[model samples]
Target chain A: MSQFENVSVVKQANVYFDGKCISHSVQFADGTKKSVGVVLPATLTFNTGVPETMECVAGACRYKLKDGDWQSSRAGESFSIPGNSSFDIEVVGEPYHYVCHFG
Target chain B: MSQFENVSVVKQANVYFDGKCISHSVQFADGTKKSVGVVLPATLTFNTGVPETMECVAGACRYKLKDGDWQSSRAGESFSIPGNSSFDIEVVGEPYHYVCHFG
Candidate 1:
């Protein structure tokens, strides 16, 4: 069996969503597997005024809304929108990394 | 509606497991809700020799397996075990934190 098949289902990794988010999975050296979705800076926005949300899968990030209001989020933080809100977000300083899933 | 009812189902948070791990959920300031499982050092062990695992929901941690061999895990990392393995983990320095669910 592949590494994924050996381990019991301990937990599912977190997922984040953006227009250009990419999905991928990895198996650690100790036979653990993590599946994740990633959104980069270039593809962080959508044309419609949809709310973008993410859960910190592994790091910290600073985010902002319409003007320049900022907020910091760490792993396990989750957010969402109702499909008719306007928002913009960027990684605080380094690359913005999170696992995401969208509707 | 409560904040949990307002946000769309963005993504489910990760879960970790140890025998005495406790489960809890929280809603953040921006109307975001985060559900997490906490395993403090006191109740972190089991008598049946089951494997203990955690996903770094927010910060960083250093862990050791059988004999003080150390490994560092950041957020997004996931691990699991069959019903018969043995292991031990610590938060490195600060309090250990993670969101978890179990079967």
Candidate 2:
């Protein structure tokens, strides 16, 4: 869906990479937490504490997992990153919009 | 409150001024709309279509409404702008986080 319904959204944003990446936390009634975020034109490395699935909502990105080749993810696509791993994401031209689901 | 509960939030963000300002739209069941956003350290001008109340969630900014003196809004504080008017906001050091209430 284009939007999440019946959820709780935190007012403050989580800024990363000196504002190149910004996200707002969203909490579900069932205790599941997600984040809607955007990555502006930049290449950044991110480490994940928990297993995460990055679902692309708009724009596009090329991401690489540890020891893996870079792969593209566009709108309506998703990529998974294992817990305790790091990934590098590259965005250019347009900002990459995503919904990050955590487990 | 620090968060909005039982609301719908769009997945994508509204990027303005080449990503200097970013916001996500939140919808209430009552059909009211608000935005949770952050502005990176920069000076920017914004024009409002509807009256808006910008509630600071974190950081701070100095703002000047049309024909008004510059004023500061910090965390836990708020400032308002009239509809069809413009305002200048200056943020330094840190990104200014806000929840924008519309009327």
What TM-score number comes out for model 2?
0.99
Across residues A1-103, which tens digit of lDDT does each residue of candidate 2 receive? 8999999999999999999999999999999999999999999999999999999999999999999999999999999999999999999999999999998
TM-score of each: 0.29, 0.99
The per-model DockQ list reads 0.02, 0.96
Give lDDT tens digits, candidate 2, residues B18-47: 899999999999999999999999999999
Measured with C-alpha atoms, the lDDT of residue B66 in candidate 2 is 94
Candidate 1 CAPRI assessment class: incorrect
Which 10-residue window in model 2 chain A sums to the lowest lDDT?
Answer: A10-19
In model 1, the Cα lDDT at residue B86 comes to 48
Interface RMSD, Å, model 2:
0.4
- Please tell me the interface RMSD, in Å, for model 1: 14.0
The numbered model that scores best in lDDT is 2
